[model samples]
Target: MAVYTEPTDEELATLLNAWGLDGLRNFKGIAEGIQNSNFLIEVRQGRFILTIYEKSVVLDDLPFYLGLTETAANAGLPAARPIRTQDGEMVQMIRGKPTSLCTFLDGVSSQHPPSSQTRAAGAALAQLHLALADYPQKRPNDLGPHNWSELWAGRAAHSEDLEPGIAPSIDQDLKEFAANWPRDLPRGIIHADLFPDNVLFLGDRVNGLIDFYFACEDFLAYDLAVMLNAWCFEANGREFDLVKGRALIMGYETVRPLSQSERNALPLLARGAALRFFLTRLVDWVTPMDGALVRKKDPRDYAARLAFHRNARSAADYGAPE
Candidate 1:
């Protein structure tokens, strides 16, 4: 979360008044993520996070995101629960932007997670999928395979500029994913962006999962694919660490075993996951927002990952059991 819109003390006070929270001790902008403006808010009762939604998040989709986290939290998942206003509204508006207050979860994000931590993350993610198995609400994966072409449109040169011959490789990967994307895998709510920054860890345990803005109904294995790219890869974003990948998949399977079909489709799913992030990052690099307090991630990181996944023939390539 980044500070794109700066709200004053009086404005914050008025907003907190609606929630019956008084005496704002302190508030500070969080500069970790790229999508929303987040602030750590302290009041008489306790600490909370005030998130101001920025661009790319549809205002209409707020309820689904909030409900997903609420459901997950209620089901005993370590997820941040939404705080409702006195009027029972989970979403509010501040400075003409959609906003909400979420209970602060205690833990720190690990930038370079060890194998043990990855194992816990994998188990936690599987537990999250199980918790949302019967979630009544459903939201489409807006950034799924079908939307990649549009996101990649007009960005070929940008890819080539970053590295020669990368554009054609990306184009070929997109076509292959479109033609071979899985159809009948287990489907449910997925935390599409389950990167380390989005998960809080207290030692070896996963304290909480945050930033459900990208959560949507999609292939369950696809979430694992996202994690493979997110947690199993080294910090340099070049090589995929087999040891870490094995620990993560084993931990996940302990909670929810993968079917043979899911295992067979994992390599393709991993490629798709890498492509999704690469395309989005490329777009952001090409057409960046001016004066926005957001960091444009290096798309080349995902590009290197995509190149690696291209040669992967099975889940074993990611250190999963054959």
Candidate 2:
């Protein structure tokens, strides 16, 4: 749930004046995202998703993510374009939190991804990776490979606190994974978080990618690895729809094919991606935070995914790449 900090119509009108978007209009809260508060701004001329960056998004990195959208749009990829305020900036401040408006994207998320939609999603994601090439900004990767290990080492020690106990041999599993996992693969910009909610769809085609709050400088394959975990796995701990997975990989490879090194590293990176989400979920489960309108995504939701990666050795474990 997207939280809207209560701003009276008068206050918002004043805000528009301050931002030079005056001749402004009405606005209503958008109840969707868990990380930020969003409002649908209805000005006399147009509409936009007014996002108030909640705590999860660091204000300083706003430009990088926003600039990424600009870059993606330039690449002919689908995504929201930021509207400039009177000061000619893409971001602004409202009540201490960074607030900005982006064109309201249409469509809904595809939970049971169709093959065509999956292919389109794959193509767009690949385009995003291509467009992100040579970009000269770096943001802290909250879910980098190293961070995954550190989190496991740190949190494993506190198993008593983490609800899912140290499954008797959790540490051993972690150690074995660390030792056997492949490394030194392709690296670059990654959408560390690409869950269903972050994407939009129309029928079967992906309309746009949203929430680059977790974008970072990491292995490009890592992003694909993230998607494998997201789009391929199903609700009952089953991995279905190999064609969907292939569509994604095919679309991505159409733009930039994975090297042998990246190919070899996919399993481990996929494991790393699974663990990253697991720890975040575990952490959230252990200590639920407050006052955020968005519902915390379940931590245990990715357990089966981690288990699959745990048993993986090559891309074949993910299913034969198309």
Candidate 3:
């Protein structure tokens, strides 16, 4: 969702030829996310997205990512399907980087989503989980709790510079999570980072879910927890919106209800989710890529979310039905 590599006209022509597409009308670099170099291209066949894998996406993992997305799309989900080249390979090379082309999904991503849209997003997420229940392929959550400490190592002073005395609390969170992270919850493929910008909406319905780069095998309820921290938060990231929270959970239940164990473990899972985002954002904040056309998200936002989650007592605190 960023553009570090700019493909030249000849390269674009070669790519289009490889894909058997012609009449390239327009092309432009997308400059939103931090992971990959993305471009929007319109050809004779149709509009499409071209993603050049950057450092964060491992080259070997492309199959899992692309295949999972293809599975979701095949199941009638609004996921962008990866377009194979004329040789039937899902990936190609551009400037020595692993590159891909996917069908362009049609909808606009919301910046400040309403409760109705949040509700739809929740339902879409559940639908995704159900769609991939027997997906067989598994990619471990590389950014899960086990890796947080490594990501958090030696950045306490830098964290303090952003917000005074916040790093100690983050450390405490890590300890608490280590002692009590959930073990026996129902696990499945999860869109681990389904933030507002990742979901596209038309009216109150979810039209598409993009950015499956962070997708992995994890607790199904943990996916909901990620959404809670993402969609139900106020703009300032300090206050939780109860109405939106209730709507989101209720919407998700319409597709797939949470088990009792999942319900019981929500608060801890939420704290862990918030911590995961905070730590990653902290890392990116402290040491940004030199030439990437990407935005360095504020780690303090998730720091605020972590504070809220620390005080949450149970599932009801997140507007889950009792």
Candidate 4:
């Protein structure tokens, strides 16, 4: 449960009315995202996801993300398009924070090994890369791992009120890695967070991708690396279906093939991706934010995942797809 913002049902309905999107028959908070207070709102036989942006959201960059989704939607990709108010503004100030409504995306989130849904999720992610390839909009890539680590690491190290288990050394390690990780590779719009929770599936197919707040401009390979961290691994700290990796890469390659150089960079890229999540999780552990209703993700969990990458010889080292 992410609590980036909290609004009562009455407050939400009032906000909807203020924006001319009223007539809400029902609504409830969505329990998945950790960055915003989200809800699935119902009205006129349709559903929508409403978010009240929190202090964490960069107000000026809101247009870049919201605009990306709108452009990606035009490109035939599955992502939420921010609906405009009657006045035609994409984002409106609500309750002193940025708030907006999106057409409720269809499908459920994949939690573990992807069950029967990995291939389609893989294919759709590729499609997303293809769709956003030509959109002319550009913004700084602000949500990569290094920034995530820096966001919490500073507060964690300075906090003396947190639990003893929260180690501050992760901040140093993450900073070192960020300073030295490889750059100079293929760059494009990366969906910086494509975890199972962020990807939605219908039946055996991927129907939508959510959580664009972390989206940015980075190496396309880095996007694939994020998928390998979230989709291709197991919960008990082991590698399972490696084809999830193949399906994802193959699907993306169908639209844009990886150069030999890109392929060679993936292992190191995956290590960088792994360390990114580990560092963020560790920072949150040391300095949990006050009034945050969301459950803090375990940084140690990713630290353990990093160990698996340490042993990875190649994507093939995990076993090929059937």
Candidate 5:
């Protein structure tokens, strides 16, 4: 259902032929992602994922995204490497959109992953950071705190309609972030969006870390904060799960430990992460794109998260050790 532009069978076969791949047995659209149109492709060589870059993706930034994943995959992480064509090009044009194919990883994403799996995901993310530590390319975090005001500008009424009286809190959050955002922390390339759905797991071990569209250079602890906001919250987003929080931080530290400064900045970083998601979701809710097959996410889910982050006193509040 997420296939915004369906390639004809002949077109798909032609695309595969260019890669020296033939006998395309089956290809079906994957419904999990919202940024790009993805298909589960099966050919004679193996199973793969073909992604059609949506308008939301910047064509020039494709190389940075794909190359980062390649770096992670080559470093023995469970990342899906981009498959190049016979001409050695990692991307091709299909239906006038940039497209790339990657080896399909075998595993399922959990909607409600347990603490054990959450721990594994945390460790895997740390491994990804270590793997890409020396990766030379740089791309700014387009959705970081710097862009929150622009994203939320003139959308106050829309936000208030969704959840009455919520606009002022969001305004105050942006103001607080402007004044108090961390200036010094360990900086590196981060996965940026390691939500549960982005990680594929097999029995508490990560099999694949897919979706590198949001990867960028930023404070590494901010990446951990993103995961904490994502993986440590209950479904309602109101209740923070202490056991999962402990497991996630413990797992990541086993691979790469966080600095005291990073730990101290966790609360604010988590709050900023929550606001980023909220603003993006609010944009989608207020402005529905035609022909885009994305199910608009509600902003209130993150609003609840923001409220919790607003009150959190320190890393210990999030179950991180002293």
Candidate 6:
């Protein structure tokens, strides 16, 4: 349902021909994403994912994303490699929009992943962090704490309409995060959006991580916090699953151990992660894209998550060993 642009057979053949790929057998619009128009392209050569940048994605940041994924793939990470055309361009114009082709990864995304899968996801994330440790390119997190206030501007009334007391809660969260946002945490490239749908699994292991569109440089622990909010919680987003959280943390630490400072900051970072998702979802809910084949995720789900994070005083609350 995320296909906003429909490419014709002729167009497909022309595009593939430019890349020196033979015979476009078939292609179909992929429905799993909300931010971009995607198609699963099958040709005489191989399978690839063709992504057309939507209005939401900034055109200038495409290189950083493409480069990061390419770097991760080159470093032996299970990431989809961006394919270059005969002209050596990884990105090209198609259908009057910036588009790119990436080698298709084989796996399925799970909505209700088991704890073992959660552990694998954590390990995968840590592996991603390590893989990008020496990556020279840097893109600042556009949705980091500094930008949250701007995103919340003029949305108080909309928040109130969604739920009576929600506006005040959000305002308080904004103030708290701004005041307590950690400044000295270790920084690196992070998949700022690592939700369940962005990760693919083959049996119990992670097959690949996709959607580098939101990759950025930020606090490394904050990335783990985002994963915890994403993978360790129940589907309803109201309850935390301690066992899953423990497994995930253990798996991550096996690759990259958290410093004491990072451990101390996890609760606050988790709260910020919940708020980031909540604000984005709230904005989407209030001003949805017209005629877009995308589902509007309920903002209240992250609202419930925000409430839980507020009361979590330490990493121990998230099943971290004391």
Candidate 3 wrong stretches, greater than 4 Å: none
Question: Cα miss at 109, model 1 (Å)?
Answer: 0.8
Please report, as a residue range, the 10-residue window in candidate 5 with the lowest summed lDDT.
288-297
Per-prediction TM-score: 0.94, 0.89, 0.94, 0.82, 0.95, 0.95
Error of 4 at 184 (Å): 3.3
Could you tell me which 10 consecutive residues in candidate 6 have the lowest summed lDDT?
286-295
- Residue 210 of candidate 5: its Cα lDDT? 90
Give every collision pair in model 6: 1-31
Listed per candidate, the RMSD to the true structure in angstroms reads 1.8, 2.7, 1.8, 4.3, 1.6, 1.6
* True lDDT of residue 183, candidate 2: 55
Q: For candidate 5, write residues 25-117 as lDDT tens digits.
A: 888998856668899999889999999898878889999999998899899998888999999998999877999998899888999999999
Q: What is the C-alpha lDDT profile of model 1 across 203-224, one tens digit per residue?
A: 9989989988889999999999
Give the residue spans of candidate 6 off by over 4 A. none
lDDT of 3 by residue, 1-322 (tens): 4467888889988988999999889898977567688889999899999998877788899999899889999999999999998999999998789999999888888887899998899999999999999998889999999999999999898999999989889899989998999899999999999998899887887878898888999999999999999999987689999998998999999999988888889889999999888888898887857756456789888889999999999889989888
What is the C-alpha local distance difference test score of candidate 2?
A: 0.74
- Pairs clashing within candidate 3: none
lDDT per residue (tens digit) for residues 104-206 in model 6: 9998889988899988998888999999999898888889999899999999998878767988888888888878889899899999888888888999888
Each model's lDDT comes to 0.90, 0.74, 0.89, 0.71, 0.90, 0.88
Model 6, position 212: C-alpha lDDT score: 86
Once fitted onto the true fold, the runs of candidate 2 whose alpha carbons sit more than 4 angstroms away are: 2-4, 18-26, 157-170, 176-183, 291-294
lDDT of 2 at 290: 73
Q: Name the runs in model 1 displaced over 4 angstroms.
A: none
